[model samples]
Target: MFTRIASALLVAGLLATSAPAAHAQTTAAKKAAATKAAAAKTAAAKKAAATKAAAAKAAAAKTAAANAAAAKAAAATPVAPKPAPVPLTESLASAGIKDALNKGIVKAVQFASEPDGFNMNDDIHIPFPEDAILMKTTLSKFPGMNTLISTFETQLNRAAEAAAPKAKDIFLNALANISITDAISLVTSGSTDAATQFLRKNTEAQLITAFRPDISAAIDQVGAGKAYAKMTSQYNRIPLMTPVQTDLTAYTTQKAVDGLFILLANEESKIRKNPAARTTDILKQVFGR
Candidate 1:
């Protein structure tokens, strides 16, 4: 009976110790499972966040691409052409003529009034008078006569240059008095210097008449008169040579007037053809088309 009781006690002690060990093992397994589940959950959360971020980045890239395409399409589109201007009117044409004439006169005076203006310009340089060609030809044979002839020609040009400024007032006065009856015809005439031509036709006689006194004064002032007298005196001294009598003042005045008209015509032609020469709004309005 004591052996049986001891055996039971030993068996019960072994069972009790084994029960505690089993309980401990079960608790350890539960804790390990919980930790594993928590790790899986955290990993899933990180994966989900990464997928969402990737989707957002793709959407942004798509939007940027769409915007770029739209911008490119807009840039490739063609723009509409501008409308044509209205037909020119009579009043505008008249205004244009006045403006062009005024501008021409201004430019003419500026070009011809300066020192060496007429002397240097090949187109307008006043050579010795046509009637005095015999005198010039005969004088060329004499010693030192070439220098005198050249000096006299230069003096004539100098006189014209001195008298050029006086023409501006005369030109403006003529411009003011003239009527543009056929202004549209004049403007659309296709002639480059039509306005200048019209002005010359109407005003040339009066201009010459008004301009002679200034030319005569300028001739005396520039020593052209004394030069002419000296030339004539020298030529007259030659034996058996027909006396070369030429009107110096009349020749110089007419030549000066001719040069001024030529310059004015050129200026008018420039305004008609070259857009850059149209300095005023009225000029541009008339001629820019």
Candidate 2:
């Protein structure tokens, strides 16, 4: 009976020790499972964050590429140049006046410089001096006096025609020296011959002074002086006739200058009124308006 009781005590001790060991193993297994599950969840979250970051980076790259492409295209496009500004009205008017007047002067000079320019054209015909008209009338009654008067008048016209070309340079010089302070006013003036009138008012005295020598030379070349001397000699021989002393050079110069101005005025009128007369680009630009 004592052996049986000791055996039962030993078995009971053995079972009690095994039961505690089993309980400890079960708790260890549960802790390992929870740790594994937590690690997997963290890994999954990290993977999802990595994927989202990659997508965002890719989208940003795409947006940047698109912006770069747009910028490159903009750089490749050609831009148009800006147009030139229009000239001022006053400047245009002034230039137009100068060009028109120059052209008109050239035309007038060319026409008057031609043969029979003054004699054929009654507008510019040179006759015997007005101051000596009574001398002509008194001499006309004498035999061969009519022939002398006619010859003298023809020679006077020849002198003027010969002298016409020399006046062109003087005129051009005067034109070059002229100051057009009121160019706009002159252009807007309603008169067709306004430019010519202006030129005459400014340059007439200069023209006469410069042209008298040329007129005297032309008169001598064309035998106008000798013809005048002959006419005067006959007239001076008349009894009780008032002695007439007229400056042939001065008279012829004045008449010649007057003729040139008349022609110049006509040319200016044509330019102002006729569209076809605006031959140059500047002329068309100004007067075409």
Candidate 3:
């Protein structure tokens, strides 16, 4: 009976030790499982973030391609054409005439007002007046008459050059006041001096009235009166020479007008025949055809 009791005690001791060890192993297994589960969850979140980033990169590339295509399409589109110029009309012709005249008048005045303008130009130089030619011929017999004649001629040209500046305002005023009843007729007149002739015909009286006082003043300023007085006094002193009288103011005025018309005619011809001579936009528009 004693042997049996000892054996039972030993077995109970062994069972108690094994029970504690088993409990320790179970706790260790649970801790390992939880650590593995946490690691798996972290890896899954990282993969999901990577997928989202790749999707965003692809979407950005697609948007960029779309924008490029749109830009290229816009660049290939064509633009609209400009409108044509207006057709020929009477009002257009009138406008053309005014523009052409303004250009011609300004240029002609500029040419005539410069140094040696009338004096150097053989085409329009003022010679001795018709009545004064006989007097000049008679005076030539006297000593130093050639020098006096030359001085007189030079004074006449200087007077014209001085008076040319006055024509600007006068011509502009005439341009403003002159009538163009049949502008087409003037345009189609086929004559180079058609416009210039029109101006002379209508504005001659006005020009004479305006130019006389200016010419008179210029004559006095250029010492032409002194020269004329010397010539007349000397001529009158000649034995039995008839005293010749001529209106210097009227003569100068008429000659100046004649010279201006010649210049105007030449200018108008250039505008009509030569495309390059139309220097201004209005001139080009009017005379381009």
Q: Give TM-scores for every candidate, taking all chains together and pairing residue i with residue i.
A: 0.72, 0.67, 0.67
Highest-scoring model, lDDT: 1
Query: The CA-based lDDT of model 3 is what?
Result: 0.83
Model 1 worst lDDT window (10 residues): 176-185
Give residue 224's error in model 3 in angstroms.
1.3
Span of 10 residues, lowest total lDDT, candidate 2? 173-182
lDDT of 2 by residue, 106-149 (tens): 88888877888888898998987998999989888889889878
List model 1 lDDT by residue over 167-268, tens digit each: 898888877755557677778878988888888888789778877888888888878788789888999998998887888888988988899999999998
Highest TM-score scorer = 1
> Per-residue CA lDDT of candidate 3, range 169-288, in tens?
777777665445656666767898788888888777877888899889988898888888899988888788888788998999888888887888888899888998877766666667
Which regions in candidate 2 have their CA more than 4 angstroms from the true location?
Answer: 1-88, 178-180
For model 3, the superposed segments whose C-alpha errors exceed 4 Å read 1-86, 178-180
Error of 1 at 175 (Å): 2.1
Which pairs in model 3 have colliding backbones? none
Error of 2 at 107 (Å): 1.3
Which of the two candidates, 1 or 3, achieves a greater TM-score against the reference? Answer: 1
